[model samples]
Target chain A: MTALAPLATLSRRRFQLTTRTPRELLVPLVTPMLFALVIAPALKEALHTGTAYEAFVAVGTVGLLVPLNTMFSGLSVIVDRENGAQRELLAAPVPRSFLVLGNLSVALAVTAFQVVALILFALARGIDFHTGAAGLGWFVGAGVLFAIGMYGMAETLANRVPKQEEYIARVPAIAIVPWFLAGALFPITALPGFLTWVARFLPLTHGLALMRYGLLGDASGLEHIWSMGSNTAMAALSLGVVAVFAAALTAVSIRVFARTALR
Target chain B: MIEVRQLRKVYPGDVEAVKGIDFEVAPGEIFGLLGPNGAGKSTTIGMLTTTIRPSGGSARVGGFDVAENPLAARRVSSVVFQEPVVDRSLSGRTNLELHARLWRVEPGVARQRIAELSDALGVADLLDRAVGDYSGGERRRLEIARALVSEPRVLFLDEPTVGLDPRIRHELLEVIGRLRAGTDLTILLTTHYLDEAERLCDRIAVMHEGRIVALDHPQRLRHELGRELVELHVRDDLPAALAVLRAHGIPAEDAFSVGSTLTVPLRDLSAGEAIATINDLGVATAISAREPTLDDVYLRLTGDRLAPAA
Candidate 1:
C-alpha cells in the first residue's frame, strides 16, 4: 500500500490539474480538429491520392496531436513548480518518480481520448480501416506508444528548463518539428538525405508508419519493416521499435527527475 | 524533537547562507527562528526540512538524520513553506486530500484527520472553496491544515504569517497557540515579527548574516540586557545632557545622542527616578522610559532593527 501511494497521488493530481481548467481539456480537443480541417484538404488536393490521402493526413494529425497534448501534460510540472505545489509534493514522502509518472499518465489518458475522437471523425469522413478491428487496435496501440515516448521526452525537457515561457516556446518546436519530419503529413522519402536519415530516428516516424500501415495497408514506403509483405509482422516490428523508444525515454525521464526535481 | 548542529549551507558562486548554527527543540516545544530577511532563517528551515541539503554538519528530525535519511525525516515532519504551496485550482479539501494520499494515510483516517485539522485551523468553512478564492490568511490556514493532514510529529513553518494583515496575523497566531495546546506536535517557526516570537516561542534564536547571534527565552534575553531604555527630548545642548546623565552614574558608554534626543540605558533605576534625574539635569523637554524587549535585545546583538531597515 505504501509503494502504491505515489501512483494514487499522481492519479488524483492528474484529475485535478486536467479538469480544473476548462482550457486544459478544450485545447487538446479542439487543436487537432482545426489542424485536420485546414491541412487535410490541402494535402489531399496537392497529393491527388483521393480518400487515401485524407486517411494519411488523419494518421499524421493524430501523430501531431499525441505529442502536442503530451507536451501540455508535461508542462503541468512547470506549472506546479512555479505555483509552489511542486515544493509541497517534493517535501512529502512520495518518491520523485511519481511526479513524472503522474504527469505522464494524465498526458497519456488525454492523448488516448483525442486520438480515438480524431479516428472516429476520420471514419465519419469515409476513411476506411483496411484491416478492420485488427488494424484499428494496432493503430490505437501505435498512438499509445507515441504518447508514451512523447510524454517521457517532454517530461525530461520540462524538468531541465526552469522558466515557463522558455518551456512553452521550446515544446511546440520539439513536438511539431519532429512531427513534420516523421512524414506524418507527407513521405519522408521526399526529403533530402540528411533529413531522411534524421527522420528514421524519430519515435513518431516509427509510430506514424505503424499507424499508416495498420490502417491503410502501406506507409507510403516511408518506414522499413523486416517482414514487409505481412501487415501483422510490420505492425509487430513497429510496436517493438516504439516500445524500445518508450522504455528508454521513460527511464531517462525518471532518472533526470530524480536528480533534478528532488534536488 | 529536532536537533541541528553546526549546519552549514554554501550555495554556488561561493555564497554562504547558513553558517554553522546549532539549536535543539524538545518535543512539543514551539521554537522560533527570528531574523530579518537574508538572515539565513529560511536557509536553516530549508536544510532541516530536507528541501535543501546542508553543505556541512548534521541535522536530525524525529530521530532521522536529514541528509542521510531524508525520506525517513520527511515521513516524520511536514513544512508550510513561506510561499503559498497549495494547488490554487483545487478546493482546499482536495488539496488536503492530495497531501493525505501522498503521505499514505488510510482513507478513513485521512478523512477524519482532514475534518479535524480544518476545524482546528478555522478553515472548515473554506475547505470546499477553491484555494484561488481564499484570502491570504485563509490560504495560509489551509496550507497549515494541509501540512497537518499527515499528522507529522514535527512541523516546520517558514514565516507563517508573512504578508498578512495585523488582525489576520493575530488570529492565525491564536490558532497556532491552540494547536500547540491540543497536540504534542513540535513546531519550528521562523518569523521577523519580534512581538509574535515573544508571545509564542518557548525559546527564540536570533539569526543574522548566516549566524545565530543569540538564543534564549524572550524575557530572559531582555532581562540579560540589565537595563530599561530611557529616551529624552532636549531643548538644547545634547552633549551637555549626555554628560549630566553620565555624571548621575548612568554608564557613559551607554549614553548616546540621536538627533535631538538623548537615549540612555538605565540599570537599577525606576522609571520615576530616571525621570526625576532627567528633570534635575534641566535639559529635557519630553521624556519616556521603555522596558527592555526582544526588539532591544535584537538591536543590541545585531546592531540592526528586527523590522526592515528604512
Candidate 2:
C-alpha cells in the first residue's frame, strides 16, 4: 500500500491535469505538426536521402514535443509549491520520491500520446519504416526515456527557482535551448564544432538519433548517426545511454526535491 | 501525543526563527501557542509536522522522533497551514479524496471519513463546488476537512482563522469545538487572539521572541497576575490621582496612565478604596473594576498587546 501511494497520487493529478476539451488536445498536437510542416519542406532538398526529410522532421518534432510537454507538466510542481498545495503532500506520510514520481507520471503519459500521434501522422504522410512494429516499439521506448529525463530536469529547475517570475523567465531558456542544440531544428553536422560537441551530451540528441534509426533505418548521411555502425547496434546503444541518463536525472531530482521541499 | 524540547529553526541566513522552545501536549488536549506576529508560532508547528527541519533539539509525535523518523511522525500528525493550501482549481471533495489517498487510507474508509468530515465541518453542500468559487471561510473549512480525512492522531492548525471575518471565525471555532468533543485527536493551535486562546485552549503557551514566556491554563495565567483590573478615567491632574492612590498604600507600579486612562492591577483591594482614593484626590471623573483577563496577562508578560489596532 505504501509503495502504491505514488501511483494513487499520480492518478489524481493526471485526472486534474488531463485535457478536458478537443480544443485543448488540439493545441499540443497541432503545434508540433505545424513546426514539422513549416520546417520539413524547407530542409527536404538538403537532407533528403534514403528517408524523406518529412519523416526526419516529424521524428525530431516528436522528440521536441515530448520534452516540451514534460517540462510544462513538471512546472505544475512550481505552481503547487507557490499555492501551498505542495506543503500538504510534503507533510503526508508517503516517501518524498512518491511526489516526484507522481508528477512525472503525468508527463510520461502526455509524452507517450504525442509520440504515438506523431508516428501516425508521419505514416499518413507516406513515411516508410525499416521494421514497422519494431520501429514503433523503439519510438515508444525512446519517448518514455526522454520524457522522464526532461521531467527530472524540469523538477530540479522548479525546486531551484523559488519565485514564479524567476521560474517563468528562466525555464524557457533551460528547456528550449537544449532542443535547438539537440539537432531538432537542424542537422547536428550543420552546427559549429563546439555546438556539436555540446549537443552530443544532451539526452534529446540521443533520443532523436534513436528514433531516426528506428524509423528510417540508419540515415547516417543525414547526420542521424555519428559513426558507420549497424543500425540495430546504434539504436541499442542510444537507448541504453538515454536509460542511464534518465535514471541518473530521476535520482538527482528526487534528492533535490526532497531537500528543497522540506527546507 | 506531542513533545518538544528546545526546538529551534535557523534559516539559511543567520536568522533564528524559533530559538529553543519547549512544550508538551497530551492526548485530546487543545494546546494553544499564543504570540504576536513573527514570534515563531508557525515555525514551531512546521518543525513538529516534519515539513521543516529543526536546527537544534528534538521533537516527538506519537513517540516517533520528528527529525529522525519523519514518516512515522507524519503518519500520526496532520497540519493545516496558515496560508490557504487547498487547490483552488479542484473541487473540495476531490481535494479531500486526494489527501485521503496520499495518506494511504482505505477506499471505503476514505469515502466514509470524507463524508463525515464534510458533514461535521458544515461543508457538505459546498464539497462539490470548485474551491476557487468558495468564500475564504468555506475554503478554510474544506482545508480542515481535507486534513482530517487522514484520521491523524494529532492535528496542527496554524492560525486557522487568521484572515476570516469575525462571524466566520466564531463559526469555525465552534466546528473545532465539536471536532474535539467527537474525537480523541490532540490539537495544537496557534493564534494571537487572546480571547481565542482563553476560549478554546486547555493550556496556553505564550510565545515571545521564539521562547515560551508563560505556559499554563488561561485562567491560571491571568490569576497569577492579579484578581482584578481597575481603570480610572481622570478629568484633570492624572499624576495627582496616581499620587493619591500611591499615598493610600497602592503600589505606584500597579497604576499608570495609558493614553489618559489610568490603569491599575489590583490583587485584593476593594472598589470602595479605589473610589475613595480617587474622590480624595478630587481629580477623577469615573472608575471601573473588572476581572483579570488574558490580555492583562499578555501585557504583563510581554509588555506588548497581543493583537494590533484594527
Candidate 3:
C-alpha cells in the first residue's frame, strides 16, 4: 500500500518549494507564536481564573494554534489545483490516495515543527504539566490530532469554495467558533444555554478540556469516566474524530479532484 | 491506439461541451483536434486523456477504457496541459523528477530518464534553476520534458502552442516530431492553429460547437473540398467584381479581400477552368490559383467565421 518513492518525491518537492522562498513559512510560524506570546497574555486576565492563568492560556494556545498550521498549509492543495499540477498528479499512474496523503504528510510534518516550538516556549515561560512524560506525550499527540482535524476542514472547504479569498474569509470563523466556543479562552460552564449545548459537540472543546486537566491538574468538568481519564480520553477521542474526518475529507476530496481534473 | 465513441460531456450549467463525438487515432500517428476557441477541443482531449469523466460515452486510450479503466489508460498515456504545470518554486530537474515518481519509475531509472528527457528537450543546462525565472519558451520546453519522462505509449497535448511566438512554436513542434521519430508514441494534439494542424497532424478532426464536423488528413480534407480558391484584384468596382463572382456561382469571402483583393471560391470548377472562366469575364487584374488548405475546408464546412467566437 506504500508508494514510498512517490511519497519521498512529493515530500522533496514540498521541501524544495518551502525552502526556496521560505516566505511561505513566515505566516504559519510567526502568526502562532504571536498569538501564543502577545495575544494570549493580553487576553489572559480577562479569560483566566485566580490561579493557573498562564498554564490555562498556554494549553489553549497550543491546542488552537497547532491545528491552524496544517489548516494554512492545506491551502497549498487548492493553489496547486489552480496551477494545474493537481491535474497532472491525478492523471499520473500513482495510486490516487498517495497524492492526497503524501501532500498531507508534508503539511503534518511542517505543522509538527510549529507545535514543538509552541510547547517549548510554554515550558520556558513557566507553564506546568503534571503526569510527567505521560502527560507530555498526550500533549504532543493532541497537537498532531488537532493538525489533522483542521487539515480535514481545510481540504473540504478548499475544494468546495470557488476562490481562495472566500476560503480565507470563512476559515477564521470556522476555526474561531470552535476554539472560542470550546472554552479555550473562557469557561464553557458560564456560557448561555444554547452556546453551552453547542460547545459539547466541538472536538476542540473536549481536546482543550483534557489538555488543561493534564497540565494544571485541574480536572474541572470531568463528569464521565471518559472525562475522568482527561488527557488520555481527549487524545483518544479527538484522534478518533480526526481519523474519521481525515478519511471522509479525503474521500470527498478525491471525488472533487476527479470531477475537476479536466476542467 | 485511441478510440472515442459517442463521447459526451455536459457541464453543470447545461453546456454540452462534447456532443457525441467519435474518432480514432492510429498507433504512432499524430492526430490533431482542430477548432476555434471553445469548440470543445480541450473538452474532447480531456475526456480522451482521462482527466475528466464523460457524461455519457466511452473512450479507449491505448485499448483501455478511460471511464472504467482510467488507471490503465493513464499508465500508457501522458498529457501536457495547455496551461503550465511545473512547480515554479522548484528546479527543472526536480519538476521532471516528480513526474517520474508519479509514474512509479525506479530511482535509478528515474534518474536516467530525467537526464535523457532534459537533454532531449534542450533544458539540460537549466535543470537546477528554478522555473519561475525561466522564459515562457523555456518553461514550455521543460513541460514537454516532464511529459516525456514516463515514455508512455500515447501523448496528449491540449493547445500546446496557443500563445507562443512563431519560433518557439516551431521549436516545440520539432521536438514533438522528434519524439515520434525516436519513440513509439501516438501523439494526440488539440489546437486552434490551422497551420499547426496542417503541419503536425497525420489526420485532422475539425470540431465546432462540440461536434466533429469533419475528420480527414489535411491534404485529403483539402482535396475533399473539391475546390480551388481564386483571388481577384480590381483597381475599381471591387463590389462589382464580387457581384460578378456571386452571379457566376462563386461567392466572395472576406478572407479573399485585401486592398481591392477579393477571394472567390471556385467550388464547382477546376483551377484551370476557373481561371479561364474568370478571364473570359474580364474582371480586371490578375488571378492567382491557391491549393485548398485546412482553412478553406474549414470555411466550407462551418462557414467563414469561427463558431461566433464562443
Candidate 4:
C-alpha cells in the first residue's frame, strides 16, 4: 500500500477536482445524451429499421463516451503545464509509471459513470441487450482496450504539439471524428466500397462491432471482415487487434511523454 | 550540498543557454545567482534542479550527480519554481500531501511535517481551502511549504519573489531568512533583484550572458569598486565629460558610463573634492557619492542593472 501511495494520491486528485467544480464531469456526461437527443431521432427515422437503430446507435454512443471522457485526461495534462504543476510532478522522485497510470486511472474512474449512464439510456429506450457473462466480458475488455489505446493517442498529441491552439483543434478531431468514420452512426456496409476498407482498419470499428455484438448477440457486423465463419473468431481477432494497438500506443506515448517531460 | 562543474546547457539548434560554468555552494550557505533576464539564471537553476539536462558537464545536489542519477538527486532536493506550481483545484493541504506521496514520505511523519510547516508559514488555517482562492502571498507560502515537506537536503528557489507585491515580497524574504537560519539546508536562489540577493545570500554570483562574470560576497562584489562611488549625472556628451575628467587628472581607466551617468570609483578624493575637481566640465549636471551596492557591481560587470523584474 505504501508503494502505491503515489498512485493513490493521483487517483484521489480527480475526485477532489470534481468536488471543487462538479462541472468538469458535467460536460462529458452531457455529450452522449445530447447526441442521442438531437441526432438519434433524425438518424433513426432515416434508417427505417425498427428498434435496431436505438440499440446500434446506443452502442455507438457508448463508443463516443470512451473518447469523450478519456480525451479529458490529455487536456488536463496541458492545463497542468500552464499552471506549472506538471513540471514539478516531472521533477519529483516518483516513478514515471505512477504519473502515466495515475492519469489513466482518473480517465477510467470517470469513464465508469459515462458507461453506466449510456447503459441506462439504452435500457430506457426499450432496447433488450441479449448476452451472457462471456459477452459481457467481451464488452468490458473491448471498452478498456479502446479507452487505453485512444488515451495514448490523445496524450501523444498533447505532448508532441507545442501550441495549445493546435492541440485543441487536433485532439478533438482525432478523438471524436473516428467514431463518425467507424460504425458509430452507420455500419461499415453503409460506407462506399473504398471507404469500407478505411473503416475496417480503424480500431474503433472493431471495438464497436464487438460491443454491439456483445449486447445485441449479432455478428453480422463482423461477418464481412475477412469472411470469418463464426462470431467468436471475429471477436477474438478484434480483441487481439485492439490489444496490440493499445500496447503499441502505450509504449509510444510513454516514450513521447518521457522525452518532453524529462528535459 | 550543491556542486556544479562546467555545467552547461545548449538547447536544440545550437543555442547555448548556459555556457560552461563552475561554482560550488557550501553545505549550508545561501548562495544567489544575480542577473538580468536572458542572463541564464533560471536556466542554471533548471539544470541544477535536474528539470533540464545539461548539454555538457555535471551538477550534483546532496552528493548525487543530477544527470547520471537524476532520481537520487531529486530525492534529496526540492525546488520552488518561478511560476505557481500548486494545484489550484485541490485544497492547500492536499497539494502538500500529494508532494509528500510523490517523494514517498511516510504518512505519519508527513502529516506532522505538513502541520508544522503550514503553521510556521502562517497558513495552517487555510490548509483546507482551495488553492485557487488563495491570495498571491498565501499561494507562494504554500509553495514553499510544499517544497519543504520532503525535508530535502538542498533547495532551489527560482526568482521566488518575481510576482509578489513589495510588502508580501519583504515578508516572504523574512520567512526565507528565518528558514535558512533555523536549518542547515543549502539554498541556491536566482533573482534579478539586487536587494533580494544582498538581503538573503551569503555569497552572490553575478551572471552575464550565460557566464559568471563576478562571484563573491555581496559587499565584496561591491568592494571591488572601492569604499564609495562618485556618480556624476551628466546632461549630455557622456564620453566628452569622461574625457574632460581625464584631462583634469581623473584616471580614465577606472570610470565607466551608463545612460548619461558617469561613475568613478572614489579612491583618493572625498565626494566634495571629486565634485569640485570635475565641476563645470560643462557636461556634469549633478554629482553625489554613496556607499557601493550590488546594483553597482552588477552594472559594472554586466552593463545592465539587476532591477526587480516584477
Which structure among the candidates has the greatest TM-score?
A: 4
Identify the superior model by TM-score, candidate 1 or candidate 4.
Answer: 4
TM-scores for the candidates: 0.89, 0.90, 0.88, 0.94
lDDT of 4 at B293: 80
lDDT of 4 at B156: 91
> Tens digits of per-residue lDDT for model 1 on B1-310?
8999999999889899989999999999999999889999998988888888789999999999998888899999999999999889888999999888888889899999998988888899988888999999999999999888898999999999999999999999998887777689999999999998998899999999999999999999988756687878888776666667777865535444546765566767777887887788777899998877787677666662211211
Mind giving the per-residue lDDT tens digits that candidate 3 earns over B86-202?
Answer: 788778888888888778777798899888888888899999998888888899889888888888899999998867899998998888778888566999999878888898899
lDDT of each: 0.82, 0.80, 0.74, 0.82
**DockQ (CA atoms), all models:** 0.62, 0.64, 0.55, 0.64
Candidate 2 clashes between residue pairs 3 or more apart in a chain or in different chains: none
Residues A229-258 of candidate 4 have per-residue lDDT tens digits of: 878989999989889878988888888888
lDDT of 4 by residue, B145-218 (tens): 99999998888999999989999999999989988776899999999999999999999998888999989999
How do the residues B107-149 of candidate 2 rate in per-residue lDDT, one tens digit apiece? 8999999998899888999988888899999999998999899
Model 1 misplaced regions, further than 4 Å: A132-141, A219-241, A255-263, B232-264, B268-287, B304-310
User: What is the DockQ score of candidate 3, to 2 decimals?
Assistant: 0.55
